[model samples]
Target: MTLTHFTFCSAFILGLMGLTFHRTHLLSALLCLEGTMLSLYLASSLWSSSFVLSTTSITPMLILTFSACEAGTGLSLMVATARTYGNDKLHNLNLLQC
Candidate 1:
């Protein structure tokens, strides 16, 4: 009923949708990762506001920074895989079959 709960639910739904609809492993992974980051941000912000007296603002900033790094790394890997395989489908990545 609270904003935090709503945010978490929304993030969870988005993750589920991403998993169910995305055929490409890379895109699905990115969507899941983004959903996770969004949930974390919302939770952190909620807690920070509720416990403003004791909470540090830097926590959310650190989480954002890590999320950015994760996104960058994931995108780079996706691009590399697409370039090498010419497609981003999960089942098509058979580099080890050779």
Candidate 2:
């Protein structure tokens, strides 16, 4: 199989694993999501012959930083929700209201 094919297949698997483990903890789920993103970045970079420093790579890096910010925001929201509700578990998160 070609390297690109392997890269995409592995990324898909990682994303699935992230979905599967998402119920365990909010932070863990976020990390798994990041792993999926990384796999996607790797796959995308493999598209060209030489993985040079170019605008294509720059966009994904920006996206990764954006995702990092998103994760921080999500964590803060999770903390606030848990503190207000007295539990951080995902099952208990449904009862929260704005």
Candidate 3:
């Protein structure tokens, strides 16, 4: 297809791979989320170029805002987890068990 389609597809594939293979890495999850966001952004930008008052505009903006908020929260959680366990590994978050 077009470059836009290729970008979206690549981003989607990367996100899926990161999610599947790096479940224990918060950084990987963040990267996957970013990839998903980028794909959505690219799709929206492309769609908006062809239609009037496209829903894609608002959708991408909302997604970006949510992604920013999610990143902040995820970073905070990672920091807290790291401090408590001296590492950022997902398996190290066993403090809840105690």
Highest TM-score against the true fold, candidate: 3
Which residue pairs does candidate 3 place in steric collision? none
**Candidate 3, residues 45-87: lDDT per residue as tens digits?**
6677677775556776777788788889989998988787787
Candidate 1 regions exceeding 4 Å error are 1-3, 20-23, 92-96
State the lDDT of candidate 2 residue by residue for 15-48, as single tens digits: 7787686775666766677777677666655653
The TM-scores, one per candidate, come to: 0.73, 0.65, 0.80
In model 3, state the lDDT of residue 72. Answer: 91
Deviation from native of the Cα of residue 55 in model 3, angstroms: 4.4
lDDT of 1 by residue, 3-98 (tens): 768878788788777767785687786878788787888778767776766557778888889999999987888898899888777776666876
Q: Cα deviation of 43 in candidate 2 (Å)?
A: 2.4
- With a 3 Å backbone cut-off (N, CA, C), the pairs that clash in candidate 1 are none
Q: List the global CA lDDT of all models.
A: 0.79, 0.70, 0.78
Overall local distance difference test of candidate 1: 0.79
